[model samples]
Target: MSGLPERIERGFAAARQIADAVLLEGYVLYPYRASAAKNRLRWQFGVLVPPEYTAQGGEHSHQRTECLMEARDGDRLAVELRFLRVQRRTVEQATAAGFESVERLELADRDLVEWDEGVEERIELLVPVEELAGEGVQRPFRLPGVGETGLVHERDAVVGRVIRRREQVDGLLWLRAEELPGPYRAQRLTVEVENSSAWRPSRHATRDQALPRSLVSAHLLLGLEHGRFLSVTDPPEWARPAVERCRNERTWPVLAGPEGERGVVLSSPIILEDHPRIAPESLGTLYDATEIDEILALRTAALTEEEKREARGTDDRAGAVIDLAESMPPEVLDRLHGAIRGLREATGSTALGRPEQPWWDPGDDPGVDPERDRVLVDGHQVGAGSRVLLRPGRRRTDAQDLFLDGRTGIVEAVLHDLDGSVHLAVTVEDDPGADLWRAQGRFRYFQPDEVTPLDGTAPVEGTAALDGAAPVEGP
Candidate 1:
């Protein structure tokens, strides 16, 4: 086993927001209540079942995560194992003799029913990288069962009670690292999580019956102290072969945190980009990450008083979503309609495409011809059908521009934005999908200074523009 690190929670906190969204995704569907059919199969992703259940033909019992990390001396690794524990809530009607379990219990203020809820659990395995590199780490852990009761009282007399219980679950975690033979000192790290629960159900047990001994929404968040983790999704050329041999099972690792930061890796059940983020306009989780906030909130707002009452009695989180929809100010809720971000360059010189005219009238922007318009690049006129060399500026370029450093391309159009700035749209000459890109009007954008004319040709006059061209993809 490897040595443990002193600081544990620092790395986990940095990547907590997106991690939480992943944890609660699909927790409950729209119209959150037991009556909704989608609420029955709630825990959908990253479910690790007990080995005994798999022996009788069920879901898989284990998952493995493998990723690459660049490290040096004084580097430490912390593995955060996070999952949800199944909890069964049963409403029992208080009787003169003893409490008898009932399908539904009605109280003065609310109603109650039997439902499944998840309790979050996280086990941290903090180890020094030096010791991990020397030998592997093995740790045994358990997700203890819970039992409790909450009394429902009306006018000082107990009417009913809710009993919550769950079966005990056990598991084992394994970690190891192997050094890659390359100029860059990189380590191939492997972490495996297995469900070793001894509990088993009857031969014909249903999925809900087998879920008590399973790990729901299981995932691993790995953090580094003084090292950097490579983007497995978009690794460099030299590390592609090693990355191909990583052998990640049931989950994919992505570079997490704010844009250029690479100290954390979130190995999730769903595939995601380098840095997945929640939209700024979102208020909070409504349990369905796949749906837009405006639509979900509107649906919640449209529910009847009886529906809202049932939803409020469903769960605490569901009630909170209901409150957000019903209590939000008009200005705050309007923000959910839309938001525009990352405007590259502004467009100028379009009398018809003005701030007052609507393009549907067929009189807007008659002079705006994307293909016929000409822009000055390095003091040379370049437009459609002209060849130019791509010279993406160093400090002004994004990570994607690194690949287009010295590539030559043909000008597809000269686009203008509503912000009163001009941009040039071009297609790479060597790209096999260049024709398809032009046909679809999806061209890469760049500033006038980023390109140089390759051929000496006169500027194009307004014959006609690229027919039905969309806006530039990006700059």
Candidate 2:
């Protein structure tokens, strides 16, 4: 992939991160029981509810996500949607004999065994696409399946059925918008994929026990022939309300948006990449070959040993992933390191090849010591009174009005949260002159990673007094 442009490569990497986030969003470890506390938060991202939600007395907030794109007249866009499905197994356990029949008395609790039942009937949906005009006139088209498993069949312009197999529980749907038909201009086009399915409630279950009808881990890969890729992290004006509404409800929304528009603009974790479609010259053993292996290693490391066994038993793919992680020889590690070195040399960023290790508490008293713990601002240590620039990106929360990217601010204080996360309180450098003591609200709290220290401003040894006023109680 060195043949690809650097911007395209960055976009691809960002997209991959987003996709990985989506894949593991609601993924619970093996022994996937409904009663598990960790499993309660399933289907949080890209949830498309079926029409049956109306009958079930629940509102379907959204059924599809739309992205605005600019394409040249002759460009073809490729869309890919990948997601996993829930599979269940039922096993019978012998009931303990207390005062039951004499024949039942012979069997003890240790004698009981559980056997794997055949797979359950997989749910099907129709993932149809529509190209909307400027006036919102939708021209529906069936998104046909590309592969040989025959999972998707286009019946008409309005419907495309997705038939997933029991063995192949997950799905990957591919659709391409070929050459535009009949005087259709490609500039400022609207593309929407509907996860159309009817909700089917579980038999012999109460209303409260019903699960979400539709769930999809969708990542749109838009390949433009002649046009440049803009952004997957920004949402259109029309979709902002929906995004905000979902955020207010404390749920992860699909809209990625306008960062400075009132509160923090949240983006969808959905991954997207736009790349040239031409086949690359084959390098016998490129770094890209080990991408999946690396991902598997990371995922396997996250699981406990018991969970690993359960994963191996239920999922062949998971088993294979674990095996790959285990079977990697020292030579492979050396090659991977060499690949990283090459990448760093090409990119001119020393940060590219650094290995990221998970944060662990080595001993007791892991809490942050406000005086001793120095805040890292874009890899450099900075303290109170230090001038810094806000890093560009959407923040989880925009409490202190640090929404503007590359905005400069002056550090007022370093505060530590109850959870041991350190935050820097900064007052915007351009803010209207106000009494620092009285206008503490103007000072925003930001994580150290969100800002970069500016030069010539040495870190102050002690916290600066707000305009020589008395110290405030909290951030």
Candidate 1 Cα misplacement greater than 4 A, ranges = 1-10, 55-57, 345-475
Query: Candidate 1 lDDT, tens digit per residue, 1-475?
Result: 1343423355466578889988888888899877887887778898988888886745888899999998768888888889888898998999999799988787654568888878888878777787776558988898678899999888999988999998899998889899999689999999999999987678887778778788888888998877889999899999999999999998889988878888889999888898888898999789875878999989999998777777777777888998989987888889999999866424443576555434344236565777688766544567788798888877663688768978999998887777757788889999999999999999988877777779965433442332322333223
Q: Which candidate is the best by lDDT?
A: 1
Name the TM-score of candidate 1: 0.72
Following a full C-alpha superposition, what root-mean-square deviation does model 1 have from the true structure?
13.1
The collision pairs in model 1 are 346-421, 347-417, 347-420, 347-421, 352-365
What number of clashing residue pairs does each candidate have, in the order they appear?
A: 5, 2
Top candidate (TM-score): 1
**Every model: Cα RMSD to truth:** 13.1, 17.5
Q: How far in Å is the alpha carbon of 296 misplaced in model 1?
A: 0.6
